[model samples]
Target: MTNSKDLAREIVEGTGTEVEKGRGPSQASQITALARERYELFMSEDGRPYGVKVDGANIALPLRGKAGLRSQLARIYTDAHDGSVPAQSALTDAMVVLEGVAQAADPRQPHVRVARGDGVLVVDLGDADGQCIVIGPDGWRREQRSPVLFRRSGAMKPLPLPLRDGDGLAKLRALLNTDEDGFRLLVAWLVAAFIPDLPHPVLTFRGEQGTGKSYSAKMVIGLVDPSGAPKRTAPRDIKSWATQAFNSWALCLDNVSIIPDWLSDALCRAVTGDGIVDRALYTDDDVVVLEFRRVLAMTTIDAGALAGDLAERLLTIELHTIPDRARREEAELDAAYSDAHAGILASLFDLLADVLRVLPDVQLTERPRMADFARVLAAVDKVKGWDTLESYKATARDAVADVLDGEPFAQAVVALVDRAGPGGIVLTASELLERVPAPDRLPKKWPKDPTRAGGQLKRLAPALRTIGIDVDDSKRGPKPKKQRLYHLTASADRRCETASPASPYDPETDSDQQEEGGRYRGDASGPPATRGDAGNARGDAALFVASPQDTGPDQHGYSRGDAGDAGDAEMHPLSVPAPRTHRTPGQDAEDAPQDARPTTPCARCSRAQWNAEGSPLCLDCRTAA
Candidate 1:
């Protein structure tokens, strides 16, 4: 009787000679019939199946035969044999055999299997042997892994600490520098990490040097995935973002000094599970094949580094560096971790359990910023009797206000509105340039030209929208140079519970104080009338008309008859005064028009001002004109 090895070798080496000689079945049939038996014998003998297995997922793909492994052995033998031709040939033959065997393996029959399905979070039920729960945010749950799962992936393996209540949790919270809002935000972030499909806001820790920004980030990240290390270099460009964030669970842009607009936009998408695409490296194909999502955190000395859209997707946490300039020793921190790591993890699991328990009847009355996170926190609050994450909502409101306030353009717009009073102001870009005072704090990149200024304001439209300001480009006239009208009003006081009672009526004052589309509607007609006598009006207060064509009371009902013209009107003035005109030396009097016609004695030599028509010019000036 032949042993199993001899039979297996005979089956592997057969060439159908026996069948052709009418002494046995066809080689293909013989191989197919004996393959399963050989696989069983092989596994029983070696105690290891010829297949691949991944940690999180439960499926295993089997090999048809061991030829691929033999090819690897052949290569090793060649290394030992000084690259001999025989060894190289053996490698080639082994590769061919492996390919044949893989093709011949039963495609429908899997050789190995695990107890659970592929997911981000896998929980052992523990009530009985092999009982488990697999959870994902995609609304899919299964007891078994899909037929195929990625063999190698950057997916994280979560390490959950055991559940218990103690001062250690409170101590860890203190160590992490998490207040009520910060703690809620941290919990939301953890939930988002487990539920990969949820949209999450990026947590930005900001403070001066010695702040525990990095420490807080690492400790929070370590609770879920201790192996995921924080990267100090933030992705400055789009390419870097795509390349660096692909396989990461949580990307920490530690000690970031500057955040470029591109990186900010990328982080916004990444925080919310949006895929960022990039071209595969070393490929001629122009296709963008790489896409992924990951949690993002950043430690910055300047909280104001990011602006506009990026600022909207952030939860800004200002960490006060430990007082007394005392830094906790690394060992002490580690020991703290060792003592409380399990309880903290248990708290997270407890949070998740609470969420799952109350998910059926959860009603969100208000969708706050980072609404998904807000909802989760609400669920936690419902179960735990917490304040329902009100602090976080307030923090979000303040973050938005800070971003608006920190931005010079936003500040300028706000200043213009404030100066306009409770009633908002509507002004074209040109008008804004002529009337609105420049913000005291200006950014280095502030646009100098009116054209560029208009573009910059338009770029800020989205950010302005978040603060209840509406920028309207629809007012564009037929001309390309016509400036868009930006309508800025007193941003609705989000913090106010009830609108302030209507102010006392003053019949003499402008009654159009009511906000229309968030703007104080002044007269709809045009620019205000010239102030302080046409000749005397100059600077921003003067009504500088184009071609002197609009030298009249503004359509908003302001007229020369009114003792206090609209120009003198407070914040809700009808219009901004035009610019003062300067005459060129030796310019003809005929060239100057209307209010702009110079009143100075030297006057234009050619044209005549209304009052200066009879006045005589010096002979030399006349001749030059």
Candidate 2:
């Protein structure tokens, strides 16, 4: 018996001889020659080959054969790229061979067996216009070209929070607690900070030194994304960095002293959704629109000097001194707390992934300020049990106060006006005393003097202007003749009216009198009179005295008591021979009473006259007295 190797060699040799010898033989030989030629052509490619016997329609491939024979048979079975054969038939044959090979490979390797099919060997040119062949169990196949480029789809990984331990985060939470409005403000800040599409998001932690303002800011960084948070820097450096970074990122500026107004405005605009800065990236030559989405958490000892615009956008967190020893002791337990929450934090990432999965579809419709606030709430809500995020809505409202119409100066002007009262409307040198009590108390000579008080009022005008109150020249004059008077325009009055009644100067009927002296007085008896003339006094007194119906007895002393008596009194005049009054050389008779002995002519009347009514008081005196 011969071994399988010898048999394989014998078969391969016989097939080769028959194929060459019958190449151009006679009819009977021609038939055999055609058959052999066809067989040889079938096995013409590299790699394994298998022999298939075709008896009309029944096709059969050799399962067991010599090594060379089997190799040739495999190649014949897999010749899908051969041009001599019909394209469809060649692909069909190649697919069978590929399938067999796939079955022979180790089962451990991951493989999917494609079903046998026509044209399985065709290469897929993807979305581009091109052509090639890929052999598999299926025959050659062609893929349709795509018109546009394909892009991979997936969510972006969230920025990692820098804090590693629960303790650090807890401390941050505690620090934030110092500011009653911190949580909401911080959340809004983080939203603005992290959202690249939003503009300047400025979070200002303002308080006295050593109030943990810096610490509070750091805590916010830990809660947001730790990796992207930048260290505190000077205002100039912060401005430079903000202008350079293409994307939004958080910046904790610790211990900022005086931020330039321009920088503050820029930062405010950036955070409040309107900020845009010119930016040139390393990869790009031209400057492009660079916007900040980063939350700007700044720690400042003095916030008074902060830019008005910037200050308006900021969510101010005022830190107070920490006093509780127990709280301090808890703060000391940061390490243990972090260890406890490590697993929970890891789980939070999974939760965050879910949130990202849905966040893209959530519409943001808040106004710029409110939108910033909402974004923060959304971020915090992702953390379990942070439902209190709603509180930030109020903070959002408060932060926008400066930008709203007539906001900054509303209270100040109202207070100034209320203090000023009706007197404030017609401003005079004396009216300053009512508006500013202390200034008014300064010696009357001080603020009242045109050379002194005028300058002071001029200086104060700007401060008043800050609240939208204006001083104009009195309608009574021009230039040097112009006396300054404050007028509340209709617009200004509306502002004051709409403002909260809690305003420092909200007017009330029972309100305490602002000045020591009343604004108006009808009676000269009240105090030493300061204004009006004698004519006015006489008219005022007549109106006062005539109002009483029971005062008829008081009228009896008048000369015009009755028409009948008036004529008789005029004819005789002296009820008992008008008593003559005497006077010494130096004394005038007018100084003597009518009852006194007559001396000389009455000085007032220039008449030697006397009356029971003591009318030596001449016409002017009689009427006046």
Candidate 3:
């Protein structure tokens, strides 16, 4: 009577291989050896043992879990027996297989969510077959096995083969149920996710009940990474969160009402790539290290004033309640979406192709937090004539505005500046703290002292600047303590400005410095500014005099104020294309609108400046004073 193990060994090692009765390997040992021959073992980048096996297809599995070595052994036993094996023996066989492979494993590179191959991108489908979608510049194709090893989480669901048709993304849009702006932002998020190398923005769905926020978010998750359970509850700990992230490529947290500070922070880290280590279940020095980045989306009723850091990384799309008449059954809606998903996926990949093609040419004047995302999306928008990036920026600006209105410190700063008037006020941290006491929302959250108050103001400055209240705490006052100086300035019209203020020093008053239209040329009193030289031999300052063709500079929309922050600064249109026809220096003055003459003092030297260069200052003003 052949026992299950003996039969399993025969089936795996091949039926009827003769061996000396006394010298033949035992059944379990023989099965383990045969299993080792059938599967490949390798170490993870972090030094954990993993196995890859082929049973008509290749798949990578973890060595530590039942899903890996243990599962494989069970399958082999079942194949040989043509029926179930005793549970105890099956478990023992799995342990033996694990020991066999783990000892001889070799090291290899590992990928989390996605991988880049030669001129191609391999996106994990998270399907049971361990298949991946391989995309190239020409188009995309599905593959049974990946060119690179991917550590897949069992929770990841499979994505359908993308369809190619004339329909475009029509089906997808109907299901999303958002306005044009929301749709564009959503598309941007989708496009950003496929490119794993860049940091992805967090996508959030917001609305009251019956709005179908969860359904919409679920559809997105389905397209990117389909899962049996599309949404998950908030993880209890960092390790738990990592586990959730590792198991799924697209993380959807449903019904999130509030994001605590720690979770908010963790989300930020996860989107940009985060790593963790936990002590192994029973070992002292052994630890499990997981490093991952995920495409994170969530559905919420009201997340409530997001943390500033978190808000910066969010693409918050507000959804509207579905009218009772317009609302469809979840089953019906999901069915339609599932049917159209393939086509929608194809459309997104098409957009991604265009993005990658035009990425090298994307020349953004400024970069935000996820700049790579911004650049590629901007490239696609420019090429496809889509306003996605613009819509995103507009949404960001609105969020910033809301943040300013919501935060007491931010509101106080605006009030303080409004009281100071257009002339603005210069105050120390202690003085500023005295002027704006902490608001009542969170007493502990408010800055404790002048130093903390100063830091808080700095943090809120970027948001405040959007409302034309610029905060400059970079410069500090002299001395025993070197207390920081808070430079609060505002536009009388409550409009933000990016151009540096023109100098207050009047070159017109000095005959040697003044040229036509009072524009400064090289100092006539000093030796001629050596060709490119700015100032005299002593390095006093370079003052340029216009060549007196006598006309005002072009009317450039000018706002002369502090634009020290990167994103708040406005770029002038007249500065580009180098003026179609070259003009005599003073012809600029002739073309200028009389009102376009700049009145603000140069941020550096306080000298009144010409706006020809858009900001103030005739030249670099580091030494102009």
Runs in model 3 with CA error above 4 Å?
1-28, 54-58, 78-106, 422-425, 440-444, 465-470, 490-625
Per-residue error at 425 for model 1, in Å?
Answer: 2.1
Compared with the true structure, what per-residue lDDT tens digits does model 1 show for residues 1-625?
Answer: 6566756665566432333244553333333333332332122111222322223232222232344334334344446447743334434444444445554444332211111234334543222122233544333233433433221122333344264767444756767654666665666567545545456677778777877788887877666444445545765567767756654556677887667777777787776655554544466764443345566777777666566667677767777657765678878887877778867766565566557567557779988657777777787778768764776666665667676776776676655554343334555667666654575765675776678778878877776666666666665533766646555554545212122222121223534322222222232122334232221122323443333344444544543323133443221333344544555788776786444554322222211113345644433455665
> Cα lDDT of model 1 overall?
0.52
RMSD of each: 14.3, 27.9, 14.0
Model 3 lDDT on a 0 to 1 scale: 0.66
**Residue lDDT tens for model 3, 200-222:** 88888888898888888888888
Ten consecutive residues with minimal summed lDDT in candidate 2? 108-117
Give all TM-scores, in the order shown: 0.59, 0.38, 0.72
Tens-place lDDT digits, model 2, residues 1-625: 6566755664533332233344422222222333344432132111222232332211112222333223443345346325223233333333344335434533211001111124221211211222222233222222332111111101101322222344433433443446435654453344333233444446677777656676567655544434334445754654465543322245577788777656665565556544343433454554434333445677877665554456545666666776655344446544533443333333333333333344545455554443645554565465434652455544434444433223223333345454333334444544434444343244322354544555554544533444445655445423886665444322235344544232222223312211212221111123334322211233333333333344444444522111112222212222222222345676655575433434222323222224324433334435655
Measured with C-alpha atoms, the lDDT of residue 483 in candidate 3 is 73
Evaluated with TM-score, which candidate comes out highest? 3
TM-score of 2: 0.38
- Candidate 1 differs from the real structure by a C-alpha RMSD in angstroms, to one decimal, of 14.3
